[model samples]
Target: MTTTANTSHNIVFLDRDSLIANVRRPAFSHSWTEYGATAASEAAGRLAGASIAITNKVPLRADTLAQLPDLKMIAVAATGTDIIDLAACKERGIVVSNIRDYAYASLPEHTFALILALRRNLLAYRADVQAGQWQKSDKFCLFDYPITDLAGSKLGLLGYGALGHAVARLGRAFGMDILVHKRTPVEEEGIRSVSWDELLETSDVLSLHAPLNEQTRNIIGSTELARMKRSALLINTARGGLVDEAALAAALTTGIIAGAGFDVLVKEPPPEDNVLLNLHLPNFILTPHIAWASTQAMQILADQLVDNVEAFVANKPVNVVG
Candidate 1:
């Protein structure tokens, strides 16, 4: 592979600190500039003469893209390209490439981590043990919380993509029967998918792997949650906006669903008043979107990120996103 990109190329990495991996210097010589984190206000200025721009979460809308006439390509550090204005990039003839499958190992593992913890009531038991519930029980064991085995239970998967497939494999190992729905109009011929209603009604554990878009935003709300079995568990490691955080908070309080495990939320570092943040229920577990941040996974992502840049400069872009 050709190393350093075009020598005259000016590359600006907007958020170098997002990845925990050590990014190697490009093979082709180029002037490189990076920032630990960048605000939208500082984006265009920092990208003044940059031939290439790299960003993880920073949004590059049409207005911002309009100013970067020198930009030839954008190397998105993550898989999701919603942050970039793809139409504007296409209009300007700028290439946009994003990393994919880098988190296959880490993401599914994290999903199961949350699933096992919630199903077995790991946190509640641990909290009770620390609070001296075991000592106060005066017995050999304490059955303070419910424990549900994953084996023989049904798993409702909203997506059947890479991450979803991996999670399904793991679920089968634990003896789970997977049920998935086909929401899009186009799918493989001859195969039928379950309806959304059936998936919600029959699922013992409903896991979401779908992205956040107009058709999917807040797909799981009060009505959807109400359709699920009272013992059903909900898991979301995909996008947070796919779920209604307010409804989820209400569900946990009123037992709309048995438990939930989420790694993403509608807002990152959500405002202090986010309802989900205020809920103190052990059944409602929330993580700050670390499902894909395993150190090894980040390393693979960083390596591919540079690889995309190198290939683009070579006049053969890979992983181009629409």
Candidate 2:
């Protein structure tokens, strides 16, 4: 193979539809080939001569990476790079980049959506109303469900990053007291900081915005649930592994906590046998990992994806993770 400095580099975007919103292909000083769908078996053959590959959820493991000799960079359309093998990329001198902070708007909004729904028992009430329970009652409204207000409630934030801070602002806007649990033990930062135990015990609404890593995985389990107020609602809009799903089901079933809302699961499309799927509890709300799919956020990510690719071509890549 011959290398030409002035020749157009080949760029490919695998699984372009993985992005919920439109992605403006980055202005590349190269020819681009995009596939709306790319199977694992066809990845190497399709990318044989490509210089850059962009993927969102498609697996680019060592086996796939081994076959592409011309590949130089991978632009991940999303923040999480767990689908890609970073060590292999490092060893092979392949630059990897991912979008960051794109979900600051969408995720926080989704988190509160879950929190508000769970706190107000919206689902149960809706179900009751649909079941004609209100019509059967002699009273104007039935007290078969509990309805709570967000005001004066303590909002326990598990992560203090951008999303967590956004959630705090929303909580405060609703006149809810915001309490953040420090990731590490340090001197309290006045009213803003509190011990983990304090956040767990006193909060009326607990929300998790942390990532999934070895240290943070399963951070919310049976023991942590035990520390929470019985009337508290737990919300996780961050990652799935951060909470033990089975344990959470047990907690919900046993009334360990008042209610829970989650936007993610340990498995994306959870297996049919997953314990949480079988639970028809009105307190449990599970969304299909769409907290970050807001239109505005998706557009921002699309623009940034192109920016990263353009930067990489210019030897000045931004958002490089490896």
Candidate 3:
């Protein structure tokens, strides 16, 4: 693959630290300048004279795109491209490509980790053991917490894509009955489909793997939480906006659902007033969007990122979004 040279093209990476994985600099013939971090205000100045720009979470709205006259392509380092203005890119004739299926391994493993923790009440039990409550008990162990098993339980999955399928495989291995909700109400031949309402009511464990969009935003609100069985567990390794954080907090506080495990939030590094931050409920587990950040997954992402850049330079791009 040919790289952009002094007179050929200039490549710029807006936020190189976002990947958390090692990226081997491509042997492209182009002159590449990467910034470890870039602020929203500095984006335009940083993209000056660049033929290709790369970003992970940094926003690239219409106003920002209008400033970069030379930018020909945008290569997102991550899978989700909601942060970018795809319509604006099309209007400007700027090609966009993103890494796909890089998290197939890490995400499903993380989903199961959350499910197991909630099922066993691991956090609460550990806390009780650490506080010497077990020593105070006359019996060998205390039954203060409830523990559920995966066998014979129903697993309802939303957004039955690659990640959801992987989760289903794990569920089957655990002897759990897996049910997938159709994206729409249409029926299929081989797959066992459930309506959204039925899935919410019947599932022992509900896991979300859907993307964030207008129809999906805040899909799991108070009404949906009310539909779940009091013993059911909710797991979201998907986007944060998929569930209403405030409603989730209320559900946990009121025991509307058994427990919840989430990897993503509506806001990253959520504000101080975020309700989930103040929740100390044993039934809740939250991780800072690391489900897709395993070392191996990050390596795949990095390798594919360079591949996208190379393809764009060759004028034969792959994984184009715009």
Tens-digit lDDT track of model 1 for 1-322: 0123356889999988888898876677698888888998889998989999999998899999899999999999998888899999999999999998898989999999999999999999999999999989978898989999999999888987888878888888898887878556324432236789899999999999887777999999999999999999999999989999999999989998999999988888689999988889999888888999999999999999999999998988999998
Clashing pairs in 1: 3-27, 3-28, 4-27, 4-28, 5-28
Ranking of all candidate structures by their TM-score, best first: 3, 1, 2
Whose lDDT is higher: candidate 1's or candidate 2's? 1
Measured by C-alpha RMSD in angstroms, how accurate is candidate 2? Answer: 3.5
Give one digit per residue, the lDDT tens place, for model 2 in 1-322: 1222334788788887778677665565576677778877888887888889989878899999999889999999988887788989999999999998888888989988988888888898899999999889999988888888999989998878778778887888898988888666424432367888898999999999877777899999999999899999999888888998888999999999999988888876789998877778999998888999999999999888988988988899889885
Q: Which ten residues in a row have the lowest lDDT in candidate 2?
A: 1-10
Candidate 3 lDDT, 180-257, residue by residue in tens: 886665244334688888899999999998888889999999999999999999999989999999999999999999
Candidate 3 residues lying further than 4 Å off, grouped into runs, are 1-7, 184-191
lDDT (C-alpha, whole model) for all candidates: 0.89, 0.85, 0.89
The runs of at least 3 residues in candidate 2 whose Cα sits more than 4 Å from the true structure, single-residue gaps closed, are: 1-7, 184-191
